[model samples]
Target: MPVNPPPAPTLSGDLLTIHRLLQSPAQIQRRLRTIQDMRFIADQVLTQRYRSAGGAVLYEVSEPIFNTRPIEAVSPGSEYPKDVTAEGAAALAAVSKWGQATRLTDERIKRNARPGNELDRVLRKVVNTVIKHIDTITMSAVASAVTATQAAGDDWVASTATILRDIELAVADIEDLQMGYRPDTIVMSNTKYAYLASDEKIANLRQRETRDNPVYGGEVEVIGGLVVVKAPLSVLPSDDVWILDSMQLGGMADEAEVDPGYTVAEMAVQVQSERLARQDGWEVWGRRITVPVIQEPAAGIKITGTNPA
Candidate 1:
């Protein structure tokens, strides 16, 4: 019969070591799988929140270069004729003669003067709408890039590099147009500035052939917490990612702000990818890889020497 096995040795260290030694690699991998599942859930939550916040906004900035001439101020009128006595009768007669002469020629002078032309204020609003359209196109382009890159995995960085160049060129073309616009300003109220000029002569001039007419825009409406407007470029991308990209681009004033530096989402994606790549193809046992078993401490070995010092 085989000799009886020696009694188990006592563990001198903390109880934590026993807990760690007994853990299995499969158990650790299960935990890792749970974490990955949770990360995906978190990503979905973020995406939903981003969508509900708002939609794209059209932005435009313009400097109106308009021509204007000084307006002739009208003099205050008297309610009644001035009191006259016999001593000043001659002077009053002379003034009345002069006034009659001026009034007689007023009609002829007005007929000779070129039509009193007023500034074109409505034209400026139309021009602004056009400019905003161009900017909106740029915003849509950027948004397209964003959508293409969202959830792009390892290929996103490479794809966005190309998108960045294209976006720069497109935006540059928009700014290159010399939109020489001049709008007429009108006095809507006394001494207060108003952008829309509704002067009668100005309105008639706008109605003249080859002139743009006033556009009565309707009130802005919001549906489902998003401002909805008819845009030529909004239909290019149906995905939320692209829409988000466009919105971010609209917020930025220039290309310099488009750099994808250290966003939390980006960092999280990178960390997750790195971890997955590193863990791939490795057999996980409990939480550790399988290797040579560590021998336990030897016990119950009796001394066989003849004498002990």
Candidate 2:
């Protein structure tokens, strides 16, 4: 059986819900996995391109294909030999060997010659080093997740933009969502006859076709809205940049309300600018990083329709 048609409002609303749902932890984890897989795929793509270049200068000047990072062992539970400590009976146990006991040459040899304090220092260093390595590994894991998160955010924005443009053409009507459609995608239309007095008809004659004119049959009221797109990028460590949030996707609303009677081409142009705004926003961010500035403002792009001729 074919899928049931979703009500018009449900189309945009459902997509928005899904987009918000993606920001949840479960979705975030899924995105992380996706990023790792894509990283591998991106590397493969670059490698293929490099090979296809066939001794071209393109591959030679390219920086490293990908950054290399060591995978460190991270374990909160590590077994340290309790008997290895140099104290009391444990110290005596450590001194014993299978070989013949050495003969005492001097009176000092018969006594306790090994300093307990010296042994404590060695044990402390060993514990400290293990703790340090554990911290290092934890940081690396977090950094990897951050990198993956940024990648996922960029992928989502770009992917969503592509899907929206493709799907926009297929959308028949959008306003039915907020007015007639309820929580369910069910569209309830009142086809019952209604008695309208002559006075009431004249009163509503002009009002009926405000923007959403001709309720019975008319040109679909397609409200134009601004399109939002985001891209992920990194600031050079030398720049000492800080992102309060690990990943950010920011753009204007999908449908920007305009004066209802504008030409469709004006709306289309606005949409196109919003699409380009994604690239512009990234460039603005890049420039902010390079220029010496005390603080960087949040970056975004706003697109508006031009007045119709």
Candidate 3:
């Protein structure tokens, strides 16, 4: 036996209510969890937890400077030399709950503001809006912390330019630090990605495969052994490219997220609803509390001027 479809909005505001999925906190919580798992540059970084919402977010990095860090030679012996002294260090930054909220008032339904499908669309849109805001903040943090940067000699769009050469330089910069990081991810804006995907030289290098082939399929999934990710212009400038060891880019820290309840404790958008008794409506609220972090600046390289201004 099927349950009857939930009632739609009515002129009698007292009997009208938001669709069940939008009004129930638990249902919205599950929806948020599934959607948050999608790949965003923010999801590529590290993950951490703080005891509280406000205070300094603490992180540790090896004292060896990110660039030009040297590895000491070890001599073959019965016992290895004692560990180097004072190699550990910690840094701190202020972190607080970062979030945004919007209300769904009842007057709109009475005014026939949205069709039933349109009302559901808004429920979905609010979820993305909250998560997208967080993604931008995290990407910005990583961009600012990047100290390893170089300029592409020519815009990747130029037929004579070589993207492989730039990738090699990016990989070399991080490896030279002698930290065991192997850059595995490359990110750029769609416009820059189009240039890379269209380059004949790159296609020639990977034409052996049919799937995701630049020529055979006009799709580019990876280039030069780096997983390619295209980002919005707001997160990545069209002229910039980022190559990084995702495991070392640092991660988010927001203990408040788990405090309310979450077993795995990852940064997930929190959604809740409240009824305005007199107003005859429900206001859906979406928020997340976290901050992105950077532990090894050398683990990532920002290649600038990848395209013409």
| Top TM-score model | 3
- Candidate 1 local lDDT, residue 239: 19
Positional deviation of residue 244's Cα in model 3 after best superposition, in angstroms: 0.8
lDDT of 3 by residue, 1-309 (tens): 765896655545422443555555565555555544344467655433344335657777644533343556776775544544545478776665654555566566546644343344555666567667777877777787787787787878777787888888888888887778878888888888888887787767774746656555556766777888777787653348889988776767654544442222133555566667787666665556666677777788899777665
Evaluate model 1: give its lDDT.
Answer: 0.22
Which of candidates 1 and 3 reaches a greater lDDT? 3
Model 1's number of clashes is 8
- Once superposed on the true structure, which residue ranges of model 1 sit more than 4 Å away at CA? 1-118, 121-126, 129-133, 148-220, 232-250, 254-309
Candidates ranked by TM-score = 3, 1, 2
TM-score of each: 0.18, 0.15, 0.77
Minimal lDDT window, size 10, model 3: 258-267
**Please, what are the lDDT tens digits per residue for candidate 1 over residues 62-130?**
222222343355557835433322221111000000000001121221333221111011112222333
**Candidate 2's C-alpha lDDT?**
0.21
Q: What is the lDDT of candidate 3?
A: 0.66
Tens-digit lDDT string for candidate 2 (62-178): 112223454456567865323322221110001110111111111221122332222223223332333233323322322332221111111111322222232222121222222
Worst lDDT 10-window in candidate 2: 282-291
Give the C-alpha miss distance for residue 17 in model 2, angstroms.
Answer: 69
Error of 2 at 260 (Å): 79
Give the Å error, residue 165, model 2: 38
